[model samples]
Each structure stands twice: as structure tokens, then as C-alpha cells.
Target: MNDNLAVLRGYFDAMKAGGPPAAMPFYAEDVVLEVPGAHPAAGIYRGHAGVGEFGATMARLTGGTFRLVPEDLLAGEEHVVTVATASANGVSWRRLILSTVRDGKLATVRFFEGDQALVDQVLSA
Candidate 1:
């Protein structure tokens, strides 16, 4: 397996083990987190602090039911993509996340939701 894939896997493992906080080690200090939508959680989050806030806000907007469980990791030269599911309100919204890694730490993340309606329902409700 590529080191990037392993790192990505570890990142997901961290999330499962300790939620967002545990995943911090895999992210750069100035990482960019982006969630595009009309939902309250949608926006650009910068740096470690911003990423932490991103996780919290997403959880709050989803009524504390939001979680991303990665099922697969695909790696490129400097980018990794995770196939994951965002679960909330007993619904699983499949998703694709493109993560840019620099010097073994995540620098930027862009997430694409497979079912926007499900996400909106979870966030808006």
C-alpha cells in the first residue's frame, strides 16, 4: 500500500477512535477544510483550529449525528481520495473526499456528497 493510503487509513481510524481530535496528527497546521452547501456547516475552515471548529459545527448542524466513516482510500501522487459515508439521522450519505497532502500531512480537503438532499435534511432539520 502507498504510504499516503496508509496515512489516510490511519486518519479514518483516528476519527473512529477519538473523533476529530484524534485525526489532528494527520493534518497540517494550516489545513483548509471546505464544505460547500447552504447548510450552516458549509464554509471554508482554515488551520487546525478552524478544522476543529468545522467538526464541531458539522456535528451541531447534524444534531450530533454526523460522522464520516471511510470505506476505501485511493491515492495519487500528492492527493488521496476517500470513499466514505456521512451518517446522520439514521441516514447514510455516501461521499467522496479529495485530500491534498503535503509532507505527509493533510493540507486541503474538498468533499462531495452523493446525496445532497440527505445532507440538507440532516443539517437543516
Candidate 2:
């Protein structure tokens, strides 16, 4: 695995081990997460605290049913693209996540979801 992939591996491992709190260590202090759509959980989150809040908000909106399962990882020097399946409220959608790595940590992430309307409907419901 490349360095970026390794970092993401650590991040995902942390998430699996202890949720967002554990994964915080793998993110840069000024990390940004951009979640798009017309749902309650859609927004731009900044820093570790913001990321935590985003996770919390999603969990609250989904009643803890929100889940992300990575199906593939394509890594370059500074970017890692994760092909993942995200599910919440019994609805699932594909997510193409582009994550930027800086200083051995995640600096930014933007998500492109397949079937945005379905995602919006499920999360908003």
C-alpha cells in the first residue's frame, strides 16, 4: 500500500475500533469534510470537532443505522479515492470519496453519492 492508502487504512481501522473519536487522530487539525445533498446531514465540516459533530448528526438522523463500507481504494501521492457503499434508514447508495492527504493525515474529503435523490429521501425521512 502507498502512504496515503496506509493513512486511510489507519483512519478506517480507528473508525472500526472506536468510531469517529478514534479516527480523529488520522485527520489533520484543519481537516475539511464536504457532504453534499439536500438532507439534514449535508454540510461542510471543518476540523476534528466538526467531523465529530457531522458523525454525531448523521447518527442522530439515522438513529445509528448509518454505515459506510469501503469496496475499493485507489491511492495516489496526495489523494485517495474510496469506492464505498453508504447505507442509512434501510437505503443504500454508492459513494465515491476523494480524500486529500497532507502531512500523513487526511486534510480534506468530498463525497459524490450515486442516487442523490434517494439518499436525500432516506436521510431526510
Candidate 3:
């Protein structure tokens, strides 16, 4: 793993261990986070305020117990692709997260759930 990818992984690990605050420093001021069923962070989030809110929302939704267990991570010059399992609420789902890094911080993150049926079941329950 490159230095930037290592840092990004560390940030994700921090989020898994604690909450967003642990990973706050790894995000740029203008970070964009896209998740399913949410638009608060779809576009651009300027400064820590937006990043903080995005983290808070994630923590709330996952009951602050979300973890990303990376199966594979491929790092390019400007992007990193992570395949991991996100587990919470007594359920585990596989997801692919594509992240773009700018100046050693995360600029944008897009998540793709590989199994829709499993995701649907988890969401519906």
C-alpha cells in the first residue's frame, strides 16, 4: 500500500474502532461522501462542518458500531478501491468502496454494495 492508501485505511480503521472523530483528520475540507438513501453529503461538503455531519449521520445509522474489513485494496495514483465487509445490526454485507484522495486526504468516497438482496434484507429488517 502506498502512503496515502495506508493513511486512508487508517482512517477507516479509526472509524471502525471508534467513530467519525477518529477519522476526521483524514478528510479534506471539501470532502464528498455518497451513501445510499442520503443526499446530505452527495455533492460537496465544505470544511469540517460538513464532514462532521456526515460522520455523525453514519454513526447514528450504524449505532456507532460499523466496521470495514478489507478483503482487497488497490491503490492507484489518485484513487483507491477497497472491497470490504461492513457489519452492523447483527448483519454483514459486502461492499466495494472507491475513494479519491487529494493531498493525502479523502476527497470523495462512493460505496457499492455487491449484494442487493442481502442489503435489502438488512435494510428492511
lDDT of each: 0.86, 0.92, 0.73
lDDT of 2 by residue, 18-125 (tens): 988888889899999999999999999999889989989998999999999998888999899999999988888999999999999999999999999998899888
For candidate 2, the TM-score is 0.96
lDDT for 18 in candidate 1 is: 89
The TM-scores of all predictions, comma-separated, are 0.93, 0.96, 0.74
Please state every model's RMSD to the true fold in angstroms: 1.2, 0.8, 3.3
Residue 74 C-alpha lDDT in model 3: 80
Across residues 50-77, which tens digit of lDDT does each residue of candidate 3 receive? 7677666556666766566888878888
Clashing pairs in 2: none
**lDDT of model 1 at residue 64?**
82
What is the C-alpha lDDT profile of model 1 across 5-119, one tens digit per residue? Answer: 8889888889878877898999999899988777888899999999989888877776787667778889988999999877987888899999998888899999899987777
- The total of clashing pairs for model 3 equals 1
What C-alpha lDDT, on a 0 to 100 scale, does residue 70 get in candidate 3?
87
Query: Model 3 misses residue 125 by how many Å?
Result: 4.3
Off by over 4 Å in 1: none
Best by lDDT: 2
Clashes, model 1: 0
